[model samples]
Target: MDDATVTAPAPDEDIDLAYDVFARSCPSRHTLEHVTGRWGALTLGALSENTLRFNELRRRVDGVSEKMLSQTLHALERDGLVHREDRQTNPPRVEYRLTPLGESVAERLLSLIELIEGKMPEVLAAQHRYDGRRPA
Candidate 1:
């Protein structure tokens, strides 16, 4: 099946999509996953604040293994959400920052993060209640 010719989930109207994240076979789903995965989300959030080197990003995200961070950055870079710049100095200097599209995505993601943080008390209470009801 040609994903580019696939129709989106419009109830009453037919809309052909080049790529629909909702479609199971759509390539957009992979990009969406890359942007929203644990390490990917953290890395994007950190870079949204300032451009960073590889080590700096890993430090900012915390708890991410070196291999995981490397993989996450590569995926983000490939998705055009992260821009990597390498400067040719005596010792090579590399930096990572959000692209324009990445900035937009990060802005939305930060809003979600803020909402989650603000609702943590409620979330914790819910978790406690849920745990109390569950058998260990």
Candidate 2:
């Protein structure tokens, strides 16, 4: 990921995308924010496969608060990583999908997911070792 970026959100100023995560402040931080947030990465990864309604998204992603999910969607939408569509239908149909940019990030995240899953046992062991309890 030579091109990943990072940055802090400023309420009133234009974001200066570092365009490099290692940069002091990557302008692409917005995308990273979406990918690593409580509901962001999951949402983007889920949507990468196909579009889904709010409920569907909720079902696919576990352990996310409604408020957090909503916030994540809004942020991703603002950053152009996600697309929100409101349709005229019974109770109104709203679906979330990822933009091409988000898809790129999702592809990267997929590998990350694999890496994390592969190392889960080791991670848990490490955590347990430092969890303040003696090892059995």
Candidate 3:
């Protein structure tokens, strides 16, 4: 569909304001999965810096195969969180960047990642203690 036809989910109708993600049919669950999936998070994080070409993004994300990256980008693009620009040129250059909404989400993800990294030592220690209690 064209850009004009694309629309965000309506606040009042389609997505219930009181929807619980724990429920099987909640639309938020699908959105959460798309935004927080391994490649999705990384892709958003990488694009938070600036626009990047396909290969540049692939390299930045590290270990994500081309197919997976493409899929992640497509999902983000469909969600209106990522902008894909095609520069008409001899070689068909394309670049990806986070939309404003995407930047907001990416910033949140970066903060969460930082918090996890800061607590990793404590988490690892807890894991070690838990593992120790298990019978061999």
Candidate 1 local lDDT, residue 121:
100
lDDT accuracy of residue 20 in candidate 3: 63
TM-score per candidate, in order? 0.86, 0.74, 0.83
Give each model's whole-structure lDDT. Answer: 0.90, 0.82, 0.88
> lDDT for model 2, on a 0 to 1 scale?
0.82
Q: Give the best candidate by TM-score.
A: 1
lDDT, candidate 1, 10-123, per-residue tens: 467776646656777777788889988999999999999999999998899999999999999999999899999999997999999999999999999999999999999999
Which segments of candidate 2 are over 4 A away from where they belong? Answer: 1-26, 132-136
Global fold similarity of model 1 (TM-score):
0.86
Better of 1 and 3 by lDDT: 1
Taking the tens digit of each residue's C-alpha lDDT, what string does model 3 give over 29-128?
A: 6778889999999899999988999999999999999999999999999887999999999899999999999999999999998899999999999999
For model 3, the superposed segments whose C-alpha errors exceed 4 Å read: 1-18
